[model samples]
Target: MGMIDQLLVIWGEPAAGNRQVIGHLARSAGEFRFWYEDDLAKAQARGFQMLPEFPVHRRADDPYIGRYLFALFAERIPAPTRRDSAEMMTAWGVDHPDDQFKVLARSGGIRATDRLELAEYRAVDDDLSRPLEFRIAGRRHITDAAPLAVEDAVSLRREPDNTADPAAVIVDRMGRKAGYVPRQYTQLLGGLVERGVPLQGKVVRELLLPDDVGKLVVRIVSSRL
Candidate 1:
């Protein structure tokens, strides 16, 4: 399996609403950069603050508070990092206060009924300027054929009639079908294909157990021109 870089987007409060593209998380020459959509001075003037230890209002006077939250920890979140259960729990916080958190905010404008603040970013050279990579979130992987060797690169095909995911993914081998793409990525990658976008995937990992369903890890990288 190939060792690839993966991205995990942690969303802040008010999950839904108009999320302004304040900026993006990207990279250049392997250096991390948190580019700002708006000027730093302007953002500071907007009353951006991240006191997550205290109860920050989900409905605060300042609309950009959510973005400020991401700004609080922009330097810590890098691509291709693995987090354990303890870390995730710390980041998500339980019933009480939790300090470990990193999420980009989305603010709904004045007229919007619901709004949330947001912030976040990354770095890279001009050739790879856009943040085009995303990891699909799914619970299980399905297969009816024998396990493929670990790290076998495969093609991803569309499955229009898949009951579980209409935009299902069918993993392929040398031009024939091998297995289905992980459940979570179905609709997302499928939609990209429908729009005439091509895709490329690599087997990042695989683990076959004699006592249970095996696990295969496939990573889809953006091939958009």
Candidate 2:
């Protein structure tokens, strides 16, 4: 039976423009990372404020935000140790990473249309530093969540009928591109299931795409519902 699937992106700012919103999703595609600061900065400079979406933790003390950021970056790359995240944080100048962020900012990656000011970074080390491990916020367990619904999957694959913008269409077709917030995907999957959708065995995956678009895929695995 062709299930009535509905896919929804589980991360990022909803008002995140064409590239940020997650609707009925498809496969839980894996994860990927690319330079996004430019797009984000331009949007912020242009006055595009990140729209407080449904599930993004609102509290300033929310560890999920950090966890999610790390998870999004760490997944598939390799498991980073505590020392790794901390060391990378230290080398990147958690307090002044904007130096690097500016590189993305000038590249027109951050949406100049939005007024989203992201934290910038500076390199403290002389050699190219790479993130060796990844840790999710909230210590989110990756094995606990169900996959996207069958209906959501189908919708994400097909083009949206309402929007005429090709970029929007491309982003939507890309599935959920925003970096996932570690254990946050479970919350996202649960949120959709709670909405009366039948998503019992879905997992979030990643999709391959071009340079400008953030790529992510949501797959419906049969085992870990």
Mark the 10 consecutive residues where model 2 has the least summed lDDT.
126-135
What's model 1's overall lDDT? 0.39
Candidate that scores best on lDDT: 1
TM-score of each: 0.37, 0.20
TM-score of 2: 0.20
RMSD (Cα, Å) of model 2: 18.8
lDDT of 1 by residue, 97-130 (tens): 2222222211100112222222222232212123
Q: Compute the lDDT of residue 180 as modeled in candidate 1.
A: 65
Q: Which stretches of candidate 1 lie over 4 Å from their true place?
A: 1-143, 207-214
TM-score quality measure for candidate 1: 0.37
- Show the lowest summed lDDT stretch of 10 residues, model 1: 103-112
Off by over 4 Å in 2: 1-45, 48-156, 164-225
